[model samples]
Target: MSADQWIAFAAAIVGGALRVGTPFLFVSLGECLTEKSGRINLGLEGVLVLSAMAAFGGAYWSGSAWVGVLAGALAGALLAALHGVLCSLPRVNDVATGIALMLLGTGLAFYLGKPLIQPQAPQLPSIALADWSSNAAVRAALQVNVLVPIGLMLALALWWGFARTRAGLLVRLAGDSADATRALGYSVAGIRIAATTAGGAIAGLGGASLTLFYPGSWNEGISSGQGLIAVALVIFARWSPLRCMGAALLFGGAGAVGPALQSIGIAWGYHLFNTVPYVLTLLILVLTCRPGKVAVGSPGELSSTRS
Candidate 1:
């Protein structure tokens, strides 16, 4: 490819990373928070879809994109709360309940979102970061979603919360040792429930980003399994919130490979390139999941990491 083409390709990947990574960043952080509280909520896939539907529907009706974002968060919180409640019941498996909720959330979204498919809702605004550049491609590539900075700040805040705050310490304590939390007069279940709900709300914002930002539309396939991929992402990041942001960008860049190639007149392998993120997810799981071995920095009470 020529120099200009190469530049365009690189620009495309950068743009794609920012756009695609936003949702990954949110969902992975949410999962990280839940895991830190000694619970796992795999139903985030459902949360993403349902929240996307809700965000779109809310924006369409209320004519305000911010309202749609709130709607999305509420939907996610409600679904995640149900997961927390069910998992708290005696003998209920967290993994099983999460999978079931995933199905329920997706089914509900599809049913309720039927009318949303054809409508155009208010979309979130963007920040044009490349206004100084005269190149159209560069300008297009640099147009960032407003939520990108918010997601970044959230990552930093979470890291600080986990490392320096009392609430953070309590959540970590609950995950590492429920008995210890109980000894300290804290309700382990309550801490976990709150963490899971908060995580779901964060993931819901990711869903809102999907429909209200890049692609800027409501569709059943908008998530493309990003929510499910967040599990591997968190594991890959070694449960670090800051590391989760980097991992999300990496996955997002991988996801952008297909489109980047296509933009440079390389269409033959576009579809194959699009599978890069999934392939990366498999590789992360394979490398991280070894029999009888828990990943380093994993919470002790997390069932998946428990031996």
Candidate 2:
């Protein structure tokens, strides 16, 4: 490849990062929020798939993309709320419940999304960020998803809220020491439910991005395990919203590598390239998880991290 081709490849990866990373950003932030309230909702995979189907169906029926977004968020919230409620029961295991929810969510989506596979729906609009570039490839690569900025702003807001607000403190307190929160007369169950629901809503938006924006369509395989990978992403980010954003972009770029290479006529090992993100996820888990040592900045009440 010449210099120009290399440049295009780099641009494609950057664009893919922005395009692909949006979902990761939303889902990881949602998980971070849920963990902050002393609950971990691993069912986000289900939340993500179910919401994507709901979003696509809503857009196809309503002829409006934003309506689809709303439908997705609502679906995610409702599903996540169920997980919260189930986990709140005596002697229920959060991890097992989450796995069950993931299965249920995916099954529901596949069943309900049958009619949606063939229809075209309104798609989310993009903001042209490379209008100045005469190169069409550059222009196409720089077309930013409208949801990217919104995700960025949400990350910033979450960071601020966690660091400097009463609500944030309460959430942290709940995650760190439920007994402490209860001693202060707060309802730990209630807080966890609310946080999980809110997190699901945000994750629903990530689903919306998948169907209504890049690779914009509804399919049983649309999610491709991104929701599951987000669990590791949160751990990699140390549960910080801002760091989640960066980690998401990095994963997004990793995801883009195969496509970007193919775009530049490098098709060999494409399948291997697509595995980068998953490999990265495994590496992060290995590096972060140690024998009997809690991860730094991990929520105290998060069960998976506790020794």
Error of model 1, residue 47, in angstroms: 0.5
Error of 1 at 169 (Å): 0.5
Per model, how many backbone clashes are there?
0, 0
Tens digit per residue, CA lDDT, model 1, 1-307: 8887888888889999999999999999999999999998999999999999999999999999999999999999999999988888878888899999999999999999999999999999999988887778878887898999999999999999999999999999999998899999999889989999999999999999999997899888989999999989999999999999999999999999998888778899888888999999999999998888989999989744331
Q: Give the Å shift of residue 27 in candidate 2.
A: 0.4
Task: Provide TM-scores for the models.
Answer: 0.98, 0.98
Residues 1-307 of candidate 2 have per-residue lDDT tens digits of: 8987888899899999999999999999999999999888889999999999999999999999999999999999999999999888888888899999999999999999999999999999999988887778878898988989999999999999999999899889989998899999999989898899999999999999999997999998999999999999999999999999999999999999998998889999999999999999999999998888889998889744431
Q: Give residue 190's lDDT in candidate 1 (0 to 100).
A: 93
Candidate 2 has its poorest 10 consecutive residues by lDDT at 298-307
In TM-score terms, candidate 1 sits at: 0.98
